[model samples]
Target: MTTITLGRYLWERVYQIGVRTIFGVPGDFNLQPLDYIYHVDNLRWVGNQNELNAAYAADGYARIKGVPGVLVTTHGVGELSALNGVAGALSE
Candidate 1:
């Protein structure tokens, strides 16, 4: 077993789960995780115009790739803006 920070573990899981790209609007709460994810090879972080659009982009990518596309939005409003797409993906 390898010991690593929670952020690293989370990002690593995303990589292992076959996420080659991520989409989101960066913000304070999620910045750390995003920074960590940046160091991962073959993982491209695609910043979107807004959380809602970010969610849509991620959902679309996931649909085509068959992998859970990553979306890193901040807490509160940013996260809320992304909820609809997330819920939609969950339903499907």
Candidate 2:
């Protein structure tokens, strides 16, 4: 059996659902996973200035494209910053 990283599993699941664009803010924690995740797939990475912006963009993309938009961020603070946009997306 082959081992698959969390990143690869996420990429595969999203890709299967027609999610080709990933919006994110790369940080030390997430950069490595970003590199490992997307390289194996034909996915486009859309870097944003901040985690909140990335989340908003991903949400918008999801609405426009009819597919789930992925937002990648680091743990704790980074993920917290995106909650507003994520919550908004969920409310709509």
Candidate 3:
């Protein structure tokens, strides 16, 4: 029997969809999931200066890669900070 954490399962799905890199800013709420990134082969984590920057980076990556890019952010304040970038991606 093999057991995989939710973080690993989600990351596997992201990888299956051709996402080679993930962008985000580390935070107290997200530290646990970030740990799973270290164990996934061929998956790279790019830590940005802030949530907004991470969102922008992910959007740019998706544009260049032709596959959806993934971004991880903490709840509340983190999410709020990334909204402008997310909105930009959506409007584009």
Candidate 4:
């Protein structure tokens, strides 16, 4: 029997959807998941200065690539910091 990890499963889905790059800030909480991302075939990780900037980068990538963009961030403050950028993406 083969065991598939949650991280691997998530990345597989992301890659299946045509997301070649993922943007985010690395955090203790996200380190394990990032490790999985590193091993995924054809998926690249783009580290950003902050969660807000990561969100903006994902939005721009989505606009240019015509595919849905993805951002990964830690819980609490990381998620909070990304709210403004997400709101901007939604409004524009």
Candidate 5:
């Protein structure tokens, strides 16, 4: 089998698992993985204005698509900002 970096491995796995669309706000820490994921065929990365919106969007996508939605964000504030939407999703 061809060798792949950890990022590529994750990207491929997500694709294999039928995750055709991902939503997130890009930042330095996560840019590499996002780039790799976006490059993969049949996979699309949906850009959001912020993490909270991304998480909410992902949740909506999951409900309609019957698959887990994913969101990537910057560390610290980015993650914190998503908590509200995440909580709402979890509570629903």
Candidate 6:
């Protein structure tokens, strides 16, 4: 059996979906998990100042690139802050 970290698995899935650019804000809980970016080919992470902005950027990227947008954020308040932007992305 083959074993892989969730971070690596997540990135591999994202890469499979044609996500070359990721937009998000790294938080305490997500920092380590996001390190899997380095192991993927042509996958680059774009750090934002906050979750809200990250969500918006991801939404924008998804629209422009015609692929899924990946967003990373911490728990609680950080997740909540991105609600509006994510909702917008879903609506459009």
Best by lDDT: 4
Better of 1 and 5 by lDDT: 5
For model 1, residues 1-92, the per-residue Cα lDDT tens digits are: 96788877777788898988989998877888888876777888899989889999999999999998788888877778799878887897
Per-candidate Cα lDDT values, in order, are 0.86, 0.85, 0.91, 0.92, 0.86, 0.88
> What ordering of candidates by TM-score runs from best to worst?
3, 4, 5, 6, 1, 2
Give residue 7's lDDT in candidate 4 (0 to 100).
93
TM-score of each: 0.85, 0.84, 0.94, 0.93, 0.92, 0.90
lDDT of 5: 0.86
Model 6: per-residue lDDT, tens digit, 1-92? 99998989999999999999888887778889889998888999999998899999999898899998888887878788899889988896
lDDT of 4: 0.92
TM-score winner between 4 and 5, please give it.
4
The TM-score that candidate 1 achieves is: 0.85
What total of clashing residue pairs does each candidate reach? Answer: 0, 0, 0, 0, 0, 0
Question: Candidate 5: where is the Cα deviation over 4 Å?
Answer: none
Return the lDDT, model 1, position 2: 69
Selected candidate, larger TM-score, 1 vs 4: 4
Global Cα RMSD, each model:
1.9, 1.8, 1.0, 1.1, 1.1, 1.3
**lDDT measured at residue 11 in model 3 versus the true structure, 0 to 100:** 88
What does candidate 2's lDDT look like per residue over 21-76, in tens digits?
99988888877778866555688888999989999999999999999878988876
Error of 1 at 7 (Å): 1.7
Once fitted onto the true fold, the runs of candidate 1 whose alpha carbons sit more than 4 angstroms away are: 90-92
| lDDT score of residue 46 within candidate 4 | 97
Model 4 agreement with the true structure over 7-56: per-residue lDDT tens digits? 99999999999999999988888899899987788899999999999999
